[model samples]
Target: MPPQRPAPSARFTPPSRVRAAAFGLLGTVALVAFGLRIGDVAFVDEYAYISQSYYADLFLTGEWNDPAWLDFPGYDLMPLPKYLIGTALRVSNEPRPGPAAARMWYANTHSTFGTPRTLTSARVPSILVGGLGCLALAAIGAMAFDFRVGIAAGVLLMLNPLYALHAHRAMSEAPCEAFLMASLALALAAWRRSFAGRASGFRILGLLAGAGVAAALAVLAKFNGLLALMTIAAWAGLAWAIPRGAGWGWLWFATGSALAAVTAGLAFMALNPYMTARDPVYRVADPADAGPLRPGPLGAWGRFRLLIDHRRAMSAGQQRIFPHNALKRLPERAKVVAVQGFGRFGPFGPATSDSTIRYDMRQDRGAFAWLPLCLGAMGYAMAYGRMQSRRREPPAAWAVAAWALVSLTVVTLYLPMAWDRYLLPIQAPFSLLAAAAIVGAWDALARLAGWKPRLEPS
Candidate 1:
């Protein structure tokens, strides 16, 4: 006899309830993990933002910017949070508001706390975002495959100390990643509904709008978000092309996508006024500085140059270049002098650890722990083959696979500089793929071993 199947009611239990419970547990775990890092207070970028907050206040109070603050060339990449914190401090008007307020406030109040803001508060946003990101990953997995996959992905993400470390710091990466995952999840959900022939016009519009807002926020959080947007767009186009007929679905998809693009563009324009005022000559030097760069065509070269220029401009303000005379013998020293680029060479040899766990502990590390990742990659290949053979894959799965591949290729080819934080945003999807492979491999092994399958009442 064929294997007995579970009851319909068993499969019909509300997925939303399961997701909420899983998210609650994941959030609790993340909070506990973050609390352990609460004493860490050595972030390098904290002081810089504090200074920016003070200047922003000066601009607000009419003490600076005789020209309108909007006209100033300053690039305050930080969005509402930074300014809101500063405004809060100004409103409190405490004689000595404290470091938290000082960092958030317009004035220097570091001395009052006798310490900087506790790591907990400084890192609260990261922790929250990271936790949400984990939940989002789980949701994506559940939507794509099943609850098992979602739970497994969420657990893996929660345990990944590299993510945990970043989440406990006052950085934008965690939040950006969270938004990216959330946007992707929403898009996938909508796509699934559309595929099932249940999509309403308003629902589709809302998905696109949410995606646009998320993508824009991701860009505002960090420039890497453009990669996420491009990935989604390519997936959408492929979906449109492969369908049997050019129906109203494609029309709705196109309209929604166009609106999303417009929204992202407007957000970029609103936040990056510098793009408008920037001299064309200065902007032309680096292709990465213009907008987003994709790998496909030579046309992307212009955008790559703009990206490079943006990096150069930002790094110039952050780093102090050594005099060329100090490195007379180095062959490429002239290039460094000309472009003000600094090279980092280490005597300790190459970093080769998986995840940022070791890096957070001040140890040398690489992108991820190599062995598990390699195994995971192999597993993904197997899963891909299985899905192809069975024809059971969802459209979003293909999109995610393509996104991961393209993003990885671009980052590897164009930006060889490996920073642990750079990998955070992609970690969610990567982890899910990895987990899928692992689960698939285990199932295969169980079958090979002739293990009896668990039976559920019909």
Candidate 2:
């Protein structure tokens, strides 16, 4: 050097320091995850699940008939996850005398474990699953951006009250989220590697298997899980459509999709004995069972009568009354019931003293508002677009964004009931995108300013 510049001193933080920082960040995320679930009420459908665990045992052991077990229709709605939970209980030291035995044992053991047994015990799986969801989001972010983005995404997910509230509950939403997140992570990684021309056959197979398992698990968790699979299929199709890699990529994707469907079907049949029946007795009844239904005052009463009659007949196994005419009225009657039920109890305005209705409405409206989420989404889109235009986008960024968007759209649009629980699956990703937006915008603004970049000696 002409000026004999002084030797540059090493100013970089040591690898050990970096590792320590990461550990500290993870610890903070863990704290957030733990704190958010504290003091949450088992308010919405919590009892229904608790009751299902109790009754599932009864049905399995032949103590309860199909009709008795079917009284709570939600049990039949998603059978695999609940059944798996029940199986876990049986395998444990918990009593197996009958359907009620698990509940009894749970009651005695819950407090000892530092959580209430009823909803808490049932929620154990969900909590673990939610934690996994956080991890998946972090992986997605890291793979899509950098370690910093991953850690921030994980922290945001842990701190997000929407995710935490549902995670703490004994519901299927958390599990569904876990499966969906995991599937997306793996699929994105596989896609990235495939695009980079580094994916081996084994890697592709492993990724496909993981995706299949995750998608099947999601289906088992909730009917909405099917949306995840659909998203994957679309993503894979599009990825293959681009003249990028070997033709084998499309074959691999198709195989994975078929395997997922088969796994899901098998899991459903194995868990739900009812599916095997050629002619299941309790098929969703036709609208004609209710009679000729009109929307006016007299017609409404006629529809109500038809509904009552149908219920009575189903309960007593009698011939369906008003079969033909009632069928036409059923749709109108259902609409009326849904509207009345929601208006009377839904949280469109202020909270009420009626505990059940108040809680139900609050939970529904709180889940549906999406105001905070929408803000975060806007932030993510801006950041994502900028990264793409700048040619600084990570390999998996598009995949993760697509996956999140598809999952959110499916749940918000396809599902009939938009309960707060339905929003749980998207919460983790939403938090990630929100954090990315904030950090990316801040960095962009800093760059726009006259701030000089400094590089520490490595």
Candidate 3:
């Protein structure tokens, strides 16, 4: 008889059913929470996007080459989310008049939060996208570590007030967060596949391409999302070329990444006609509602010109806000992250709720706030330090380090705002890193306290 195969090791193997159930539960929680008071407020920003969607409908109905009729001055607005909302409106057979259709589109889905009941439908897209963002967080964590870490990260992100607030609103941030995490997950997979072997050529190419596509969508959702793309490039660099590593594998990854970048550029152009259309109109006001419609030059170069013009407009807009000293602002930024993003303790005083929501932070000592943060710090330190000594370090570990580093640098150094919404991208990654530290500490403790049993005669 053939020798019995050695018992399968269960130490590192995770339960699939449990992971699925956790993900499902997390998704449900996200949907419910996001949907609860989503239409509570009709923010000024929402109107901008709704108007853009109306413009999209008109553009879609007009000539392909001369989208001259589709000039909405906020043409500088991110395209994917607006395009998606417009597509949804079209599918629902919204009427022709933009404002009338906009008003009628989100008619009758409201809870008691003082916003217009008709605006409820407008928030639906955000609700759905936000729920999906939770799942994306889970997927990213799991790809980097294990199922438990992923679930923990997802659940923590779901419960966080800052993420939830932006997610529930009909804004660009939710979609941007979702797409950013999706791209990060795909980038991780691409790195894994690219290094596995030449046998994974097609798989590697697909992953890289997918990452590129997702990154493009993220950027189209918000120009700030270019940070995720930068992170991806940085991670690839760290994985290859660094630590005395280089070969055909590195070449393949570089080639795939270059192609992926080109793909992303093409995707951006394809999605945003304002970026490529000739003689496109840049309307600041709805034509039906006493217009600010202005006709611009035509073609691809025209698109670039429009973008530059928009940038100047944005720069002018930014000038109105008072600037804060960066050094003095660091503490304020920390307080926001600790209280709103991470929820270190009871939500009051400095350790308090976010700008939009008044959520009670973790009251218990063992709650997600402190323990996970401490552990995450440990995990980060361990990963960063251990790699120097180890000849062959795990890619996942390094990726996590790189993610935290890149995200932290970008968030703290470049971005002047301390809003929790802007900090959403780092939440899931931090929680996962925390979970890693917790598990690592637990295992170390177990080994220290474990007992050995002597086998007599097997």
Best by lDDT: 3
Residue 321, candidate 2: C-alpha displacement in angstroms? 21
Deviation in Å, model 1, residue 327 alpha carbon: 18
All models, RMSD in angstroms: 10.0, 12.0, 7.1
- Per-residue lDDT of candidate 3, residues 23-123 (tens digit): 89889988998898765657656765665565566456654445433344335566676666666566665532354433333342221221253356667
Off by over 4 Å in 3: 1-11, 15-18, 58-74, 90-117, 197-199, 242-247, 280-295, 298-316, 319-394, 445-458
* Per-residue accuracy of model 2 over 25-104 as CA lDDT, tens digit each: 67456645654564466564554455455445754786433433333232334654565455545555343233343233
Q: Name the top TM-score candidate.
A: 3
Which stretch of 10 consecutive residues in model 2 shows the poorest summed lDDT? 289-298
lDDT of 1: 0.52
lDDT of 2 at 79: 54
Task: Evaluate residue 396 in candidate 2 and report its C-alpha lDDT on the 0 to 100 scale.
Answer: 48
lDDT of all the models against the reference? Answer: 0.52, 0.52, 0.61
Candidate 1 lDDT at 332 equals 34
| TM-score (C-alpha, index-matched) for candidate 2 | 0.62
Clashes of each: 20, 10, 7
- The true-structure Cα RMSD of candidate 1 reads 10.0
lDDT of 2 at 258: 60
